[model samples]
Target chain A: MLTLVSRNSPAAPSGNRRRRSIEGGWKQITINRAFLLPAVVVFVFLFIIPLAQGFYWSLTDFTGYNPEANFIGMANYAEILRDPSMLSALAFTVLFAVGTTVIVTCLAIPLAVQLNKVFLGRNFVRSLWFFPAVPSMAILGLVWSYILSPLPSGVLNTTLNNWFGIDAVSWLSDNSLARMSVILVGVWAQVGWHAVLYVAYLQAIPTEYYEVAKIDGASARQQFFSITLPLLTPAMVISSFLLLTGGLKVFELPYTLTNGGPGFATNTITQALITSGVSQGRYGLASALAVMFTIVVAIVGFSQLKVTTMISRRFS
Target chain B: MKSRALRVLALAAGASLTFAVAGCGSGGADDGTTTVSFLSWTGQEQMEPMIEAFQEANPDVRIEASYAPPVAEYIQTLQTRVLSGTAPDVFVVAAENKTNLIQSGAVVDLTGEPFMEGVQSFNLDTYGSDGAQYGLSLSSWAAGYAYNEDMLAEVGYDGIPETWDEFLTMLQKLKDAGHTPFLESVDQMPTTVSAMLGAQTAQMDPAMDELIFSGESTFAEQWTPILEDYNQLYTEDLVSSDVVALDGDQVRDEFANERVAVINAGPWIINAVEEANPDLNWSFAQVPGRDGGMPFQAGAAAPGYAISANADEETQAAAKTFLTWLASEDGVQMFHEATNDVTVTDNFQPEVNPVFEPLVEPIREGELYLPMISWQRDEDRLNIEVVAQIQRMIQGAVSPEQVASALDSQLSGS
Candidate 1:
């Protein structure tokens, strides 16, 4: 997907070859640079400007309506540190991110490997697994709320009652259960998409290496651990990085499912940020929360990437 | 390779050029007619007819109407526009954004405006500060307990009792009769609690908020009894603790199916209840009172229409004409018929739905009580915390005193 060879093509020359090649290389670099100006302009206007404005707002008592705001120093940040709800949200956010990353990765890799094997209706099974990722998270959340409703008349509850005589379970009521329900739904929605990514990488691995391993009397498990696992490191690096970042910034699944309810059991940082910044008029404080949230997510996400990259490098 | 690179650069430049061209707004018409831009908080189904009526009445003013659904999306959309000085000439002033709009001087004061004549004082005062009105509110909504008549009859209770103790007895009787008595969605402030607080505040000289906000009293002292009374439903097992997970819609469905005898609801659910089961017999009642105090309904003044302060004189005049027509007798009647909202204007006595007749008196007299609407400051933040803490109380994790104290802390912090 990424092409570097044509850009790095050496200039063909005979006399005064070194100077000609240097000039040609410089020209190619200039052409490549010309193609990047649009992206640079977009990044500056869209990302950097708003980010700078947020940082500025974070340092003031800007109530979001008034253009004229007082410079309140670090008062908003200090308030955030002392607010128990923000701290609770922070805890849940970390738990959700770590839980979803671990669960989705553990499930997706195995499912991807199984889907890659020759089996009856394998393509159908792959499509079925990938269907959950097709619809928007908000819709899935609404449907799952009905399925996991605490009422006896709820879909899943009725089924369990009829088939097994089980009483209705309070899936989204108890605090810990609500958190687990949100995470479980989140993992269910995401694992299949990551599995699809792994499948693409699986197809790219050469069959000759597996054939050689098989001829050497390597069992199927050995083939997976030795040959297949190492080769899938690149995909693992990409998948886990996406998972870590996406999991940290999640808002919709929990928002539509439980709405950060049962006493803030499923509340995440983004939900708290949006509530403060937009729903509530505390834009200055919301901006401060946003600034701190971005930094923490960056730290967690980058550290995760570095560690995963190192582990994948060992496998490579 | 060079040609391919040039093509890629050309594509990027072309895309940016297109975006720049599209970003510029369309200019006003050359026609003499004044076009007043409006942002509606109501859904299009209800707003379109009203806009049509306004346009028909005043041909000089052409309303360009747009809508963002309440509460979050509308707030965010209007907030950005107001902040950027591109707000519509007319928009709905909702509880979520009213504080910002009023404080930012984004909306014009309409206290003594000619258009505000015959409008309900309570509606105007809800959106106003210190006797200066900013929004022309036309209607108010009341939420109380919707009871199944059959269920009440089965329990030998003709109606919801007046006293809290009697109400508890009726709930116990319903439970003994093998019917789920009550289910209130804990996603927001429970209606029963809001009504009791309203009854108490109605009796106060300076209002409950005035006493609390001015530091003469605290929520812990004012709201503890109400919270304790509300929590009794959960404590005594008259209501399910699983209600912490149920929303208004789910509870409404349970009521519709007769699975629950009563559900805390508002006029918003009437259509849904009827559509789900037209054969079901249901009626609304003021939430029962504590001790001998008169029963009260939990409600608020509906969101009102406000003109932008930034609009030019001619546009503002045109917008005023629209607002005037919207608050007139015909406009209020049309609004009530279209949306089933109880009209609050003095000039218009609306015909409410038969099922919601019990709510008509309170809506007309402006006896609604919504804490977020009446609170002097930090309404949304306090509401989020209050709802969460109340849910915790419902789940037996926190006491009623703790719920009230949480509000006190939230008020102090804000």
Candidate 2:
């Protein structure tokens, strides 16, 4: 850390009393060198190293289990293009990612707006919403499985039968329904987190904009569209990007909920990767899959950032 | 240009190699004692007594234990450790990681260990490949219906049926008298496949599995009749597909609550029932087989110990000594008394749950199996696919034939 920090700091005005080189000395160099070196080392080590490794592995047969690997060229990339399970996982994953991101963003904005306003039991409600994220998803999944099981004896079905005379609902067993149920649970788990993010950013947007709009006879909805949405763009970008990446990498919730069952209805790419790679001892194939997955994720993530930034620019 | 570049390149390569070597040199030989780090796949309760006994017997050797909650977490934790080159000296090589553990050379072969003397042949074969033992298995666990005698008497049956047909007829009688006939945990592997195959494997020759996988026969050819026989529970509307959702603990609770007449279970579950409802009129029976077949069980040797491939000669010798002691008469008895498992050694036997007496002979005589542990390769994948297919079959999606064909395709592809 010390070595990294001292190599790229900004020049200090009069620290260099000694001059080894006549033109410019180590003192001036060290002053500027100190600050930038830390960032450079961190940036290189944490991001660049892993990214480079992933890219290199994508071009080879690096099964995660084995030490020795061979260059397989683009066979991994070509295989991913044809694999059906990977494609299905991708489709459902995108549906889940996009659906949760949009729904959570819309719901959270209003939720944050309302939450910020003083209410009789605002703190209590805040805790209730945020508590979904507290319990491990695995436990919550088991609880929800009992609640949504497709049999008459299931908890939800029994309640519905006595109260409303409705039959059982198979939330996870059916294909389309399982896809939708996963997205709903994803939204339920994350809305509070994104809402809190919005709440933080909401405090920063000047209250004067709303007050000035009211004086100009602008309606509440108009004021929100013109003033609030523009200022909230950066937060929106940050939250949705988080949702995108996190959603793509999710393994536990779907795994616990359905174990990628009803014939791969709720399977995720990560689950497939772990299943095929670690469990099946196809490490080289799994590594190839992982490297390719990392690339696709990076590509999608950066493009989304660019699109969001452009949209933010338009709104502002 | 070449001379100037060469000078800088040489310095850079030297510096990088120095850094790499420094990281590699961090691990070296320990002091006198060999520190064996093990991952206990079983939870603390089941493992504590055996571990304590092992520790008491070998005070010089120290064993550090970590745990993952169950199957999934155990596999993941081990994978992470093995990948990072930090796996335990002695850990479980259960059915879950049998293939990968052997395939990648993650576990050491126990072909000539002294501890294996007089150990059950079933235990050896369960963890072995090509007739070479890799694990020193301690006990076998069989799962079947834990029947309530009162309920069967309510439906007018003195004991478990001998044939698959009669078992269904008994379940029919129970349902006719307003009893929930059964509950099985599809979330965990059910004993249905075990009972169906376990018996056949015991009677058949060793060359059979190789022939079956070589496309000489099919699972449908053998198992369709069993599934059709078992499907009577669902076809007759005696049990529900609700089981596809519930796990062992929930099903156990149902049995505890006395709402259900039967539950698919193992000896591991005896304590839960004893604690929950002591007065319940329950006893286990082997699953009824096709054409009055020999009663078979879905069971295997519990996780066995393995020496680390990375250990030095002295540590390896010390580990071998520990393993030999563990299999000794005193050690086996201590382990069995603590675990209450039906150990297969002829040297010692611990008094276990009273209901287990009927099963002790078969377990010790090596007449049980676990399907995942019995496969030649891709055991985990095949098990997962089979369970999912069974779930689908119950849900009315695929037939028994399709399930078998799917497995054959998977086998062919790999």
Candidate 3:
């Protein structure tokens, strides 16, 4: 007592037991790390190695067919900066990503609330909403291209003419209209799936909280703002993140619908990548564009995650 | 126990490694027959019969054929295989990849191969460079105006006119008779513009593209007039600017449904349009020229077969035998029956549909032009720029001069 003997003193039996426990813990840690080896190998080979190779290719004039590519540092980046079509592609890509994310979130939340209510043919209606999400964006785009065709014989235009006697509107011909139509169709295609995600989260909220709020004379709107909205923040984070990333990577819809046309009004960065890298054989230049696009996507993604995480923390 | 577990894992890994090593064995058999790997541009349905015929005729040479559909998928697949040194012994060399294949020395030159003889020179030159042929092109296709006979009859014109002025007049009459006059999908290089450029270039000694590419001329100087003339369809309100948003299939549908009078079409559309409307009377006509130019058609030779440069001498010889058989009269006939393509080989005359008869002569004579096929370099890049700028021109966002100037800038890489 006077010496304040440590538990690990060599003279004590408990010290020996502690030593054995430490040795067993080390062995367990070794086994755990061994279990992680395959995953680490896969990550390095697939993601890290390809990323490094792509970065190396970005600095060269590597026409896809040629193996002996000459190092032409920054020429490809400089070319991308000067190209107007590429710039237009960047602008439209950003527009589509932000537009679809904002619009789908706004509509999907309200739609989920409505779909949560008991109604006639509720399953049928839910299925109808989810149907668009079932088909590929490419197929949906083709079908909608016919529906949104600017001609008088188009499905929507014909309906409008027959019902309202209105002239055919150029849904995909005019620049602004084409951009808007693509974004709207994108929203329509995704809103239902995102709503289903919200519905799952909505169902998890306990009924006790709402009952207590009702007993306190809390208005429906106030209770919703305080309870439903706060708890839905987690779903918002997931849904918005998906919408943003998917929209940023969009290629098939605008490609099949307008083919990035009416003069680059609907061109996407992904389309530009394919056109340059695969179609034109300018792999180096495409790599540079891809590098820039990746940085942009990362920045946007991280910013969104940070904002959503802060919201979640505050709400929780 | 742990060591026993490790032993099991080691045994499994050893088994996997052995199987993978065995999988990398050579493509050969105990028999003396040589196997030639081929990547066909034609679809499997159309290519299988021809491959079967070749293997039957050449008992000693076997074609191990695979297919990727044209034009983008085939190009990308071939490019990847060539780069990886796993390319087929034989493959297609299309306009899209001809320059790359030649520059990288991935294709064998067939300049004076016996298989190259009797093929159309224009078709050969399409996939050649500096007097060396690299592809065995067997057929050609041309796109021209397919007009509705009944609609034209209603407008008091039996055929598309021979000049731009008359064509416009006919279009106006069709419009006044309550019909959509003309629709050429500007989604690509418009057939009208290509045919017009073909007419103008057909008269030049140095050739228009040669002059422009060699830096003796510029797109602004050679293309502005043609652009202005072609823009009249929109500016004069004979054709809708909305055609910028239309694809070939849409325009063809409009023609098939009897809503539009004329649409740019090739032999590929013959069956679909006929099936869509059996009662619709239609015939093809050359795209009219402008300002004292000959009537011309926008077309290119179909993608051609080429031997891979990386293949061994025996494999290459087998590849050549396959191509030679493909170019033979019987082979061409079999191919024509399978695909219904307009065959351009000297020995066999393809029997095309009656509605596609008018454009067949031009195809056979190789009197057709496609700018992408003829461009010396930067063909895809220039094609993209031109199509976009022309769309802008149709939208009235840019003038004809601006469209031509954009091409000039793109070519100069400014």
- Maximum-DockQ candidate: 3
Candidate structures ordered by lDDT, highest first: 3, 1, 2
Q: Which stretches of candidate 3 lie over 4 Å from their true place?
A: A1-24, B1-29
Higher-DockQ candidate of 2 and 3: 3
lDDT for predicted candidate 2 compared with the true structure:
0.76
lDDT string, candidate 1, B352-400, tens digits: 6798999898888889899999997788999999999999999999999
Question: Cα RMSD to native, each candidate?
Answer: 5.3, 8.2, 5.9
Instruction: Say which prediction, candidate 1 or candidate 3, comes out ahead on DockQ.
Output: 3
Instruction: Give the best candidate by lDDT.
Output: 3
DockQ of each: 0.67, 0.28, 0.67
> lDDT (CA) for every model shown?
0.88, 0.76, 0.91
Better candidate by TM-score, 2 or 3 = 3
Which lDDT value does model 2 have at A253? 82
N/CA/C clash count, model 2: 15
lDDT of 3: 0.91
Query: lDDT by residue for model 3 over B222-253, one digit each (tens)?
Result: 99999999999999999888888898888889
Docking class of 1: medium
Pairs that clash in candidate 1:
none
By TM-score, how accurate is candidate 3? 0.94
All candidates in order of TM-score, best leading: 3, 1, 2
